[model samples]
Target: MAGQIPIIPFGPHATCTLELCPIEYSIFRYRPSLAANITFVVLNVIFALTHLVLGLRLKNWWFSGAMVAGCVSNIIGYAARVFLWQNPFSFIGFLLQIIFVGSAPVYYTAAIYVTMTRTVENLDVSLSRIKPKLYYVIFIVCDTGALVLQAIGGAVSTVSSGANAAGVNLALSGLIFQVATMLAFVGLLIDYLIRYFRDRPVASVATRLKLFLASLSLAILLILARCAYRVAELSEGYNGVLFHDELLFIGLEGVLIALAVVALGIGHPGLVFKDGQANLTKAYSPVSVPGGAESGVELVGK
Candidate 1:
């Protein structure tokens, strides 16, 4: 009974053929087709190549690495999903992806956190008020906690099946926590950006900064939306609602994650031509020098 896909809860509430209720929970091991496996691999390949190029172009290994990690994890996770598509009971595949893909963004978020603060350091450090390092330190701490909870939750979810209420709860908690964390991070970033822009309103974004910020924001938004959807879908226990709905999972999870990877590519700071000499000379200073001193740097509040 568990191996087969079960009737959906919201449907007739009567006997339902698997066809009648596509959203029914299925205990059978989830499996993927050949096309799916290929898709995942392709995604990862593109991710690797894009990040490598970006790293070279921007000379920002940390940013490149974080983006690459997210993309690579996504690729691996999708591959695992494809495996599950082949064998629904492939717990190993599910676990590998659930752990890696779900938590990979922590690295990206940390990169964003670090990048923002570093931007301030490079710019008018005094205008930033808080030390750039502080954001990295604080957010990294929170991101680590989120990663732990999500990993634990994913593990619990895989084992629980329809009966693992506790695990489901844990997974839900982690998803919710992650969603909250991302939102907070986004808010913090927006705040900083607002301040930075206010102080340096006239300074156009350097090409690298534009790509870096764009890609980072898109990835964050995509992940945040995906997490929110997952939380909603999984809020009901496997047997109760659209617990094991595959289509929704593909749409919300697979597509969203894929988009994140692609967005990262487009937003890769690599598009800008890197001048090695300038980087060596400027080291870590802000790219532009806007209105040098004399006038007070004003704080622009939202």
Candidate 2:
């Protein structure tokens, strides 16, 4: 009995522990790095608190709420990873990480979509090919679908103990769908920017506006990259080489998403848009020009 492999339950609710099973029985094939997962947990907590404070101070409810939710999901997911570090064969921990971490970015993308709508309206609604509100409706709907798919897939995979190919395929499809949606959103954003710049060229762009746009763009690109990596990792299923590579997972999943979260904070729309909204109100007031015409609202550059 000393050399015999222990037979243990293998579903999401498995009762197996390291004492009963060999490390090879774990899906990860190695213990999760406690230091790395703990770092991620701490980072997510800091970002969540920061967003909560900023949201309350600025009354930016929607953006702040979405960011806080995403960060909380990351915290839970990484905490699950920490659980795995302690007990490498924990199926529940694996389930929690896969479901929460995989779906967390959907909230971030929703936040970005709403911001884009506001950005288009604040800058030049007429320049956008579609109505500004459509951006919110379209992207958010797609993001929600991706989140649902991922959650369901994770559940299915856990119940099957990674044996059901359909579950892995479902998760992969969700990630791929998310990547496609982001690409489309980025395409539309670029188109709108080109049209706006061509129609209304400014002599000097405001530093605040530049920083906001740059940070937002950086976050978008990073999230897109992370999603793409997830798609690749899931394509090979749980037993694949890429699935077992912790270094790649840490870099692409943990580090990239953390940077994206920081970018979102840097580009907090409340800071940039608050003044612009006030200026917009004043511009739209029934003020008269010297030429006996109504004053037109110009885009806020500062």
Candidate 3:
């Protein structure tokens, strides 16, 4: 293994003596471009900081925590890529990107699950096909399963000497499961939307609800695209063409997730449910009576 690929620096490299180190290799061969990696790291850090400030300001404990976790995971994953740029054969760096970046989106998905439950509760849970509580219960549980599979797969592959079919399959199964969950969740969301609109006119809907739903939808699409790309990449094993294509990785995984994070921030539930208005289970609002007299109704009351 030590003599497999020539060691770097064109000399007796100190770090390449381990079982995982290549005899000779360039970081470029593994990581490709360094510029994009650095950009993602910086962007993630900025996004994390922004989420922290907003989360604190709005006191959205759950949403803020989930977003911050996802952002930090992105930052750490890209930082690992930076280390890989320095030493492409670094097993630790590879592991970091695989587990952190691969599993980070699960946190964001959890946040979305929570937000959907809250949305249904706020708008009209009776209008939804599934119960509001079931939203988080089902999706979060599925997300946890996906996260565990990916993490275990990363660990197994890290320890496995060469291309491990079992490890790759585990990781692929996790990605596939994630995509399936996303599809199901989206179907439910669309169903709820259809039911809600069918019962109530779009004009009667609150503007805040519209913005929040749109943002959540955008994030869902971005994450789905990123996860699908990962599934395809991992299905081919480590040495596959998609695995080596840095641009595709940056565009599909990094760029898509970055946009999703930003979209969530814009559609942060705090924007709508603020000042202890987070739980709208029985929220109500003022409505007009038959005699043009204003009356209070349970329609998103503040």
lDDT (C-alpha, whole model) for all candidates: 0.63, 0.82, 0.77
Where does candidate 3 stray beyond 4 Å?
Answer: 1-28, 275-302
TM-score of model 1 relative to the true fold?
A: 0.73
Candidate 2 regions with alpha-carbon error over 4 angstroms:
1-6, 13-15, 199-203, 275-302
TM-score rank, highest first?
2, 3, 1
RMSD of 2: 4.2
Error of 3 at 192 (Å): 0.5
Q: Which 10-residue window in model 2 sums to the lowest lDDT?
A: 278-287
Any idea what lDDT model 1 has? 0.63
Model 2: per-residue Cα lDDT over 171-282, one tens digit each:
7788888899999999998898777555333433445665777898899999999999998898899888998999999999999999999999999987766632433432
The TM-score between candidate 3 and the true structure equals 0.84
Ten-residue stretch with the least lDDT total in model 1: 276-285
Q: Number of the top candidate by lDDT?
A: 2
- Top candidate on TM-score is 2
> How do the residues 1-302 of candidate 3 rate in per-residue lDDT, one tens digit apiece?
76556443212232463355553343224544589889998999899899899888878889889999998998899888888777666767777877788878998999899989877876666778888889899999998998888888767765663246788788788888989999999999988888766645565555656777899999999999999999998888766778778889989999999999999999998777753253542344443334666433232334
Query: Candidate 3: worst 10 consecutive residues by lDDT?
Result: 9-18
The list of candidate 1 runs beyond 4 A from truth reads 1-25, 28-37, 56-58, 127-129, 199-208, 240-243, 269-302
On the 0 to 100 scale, the lDDT of residue 198 in model 1 is: 69
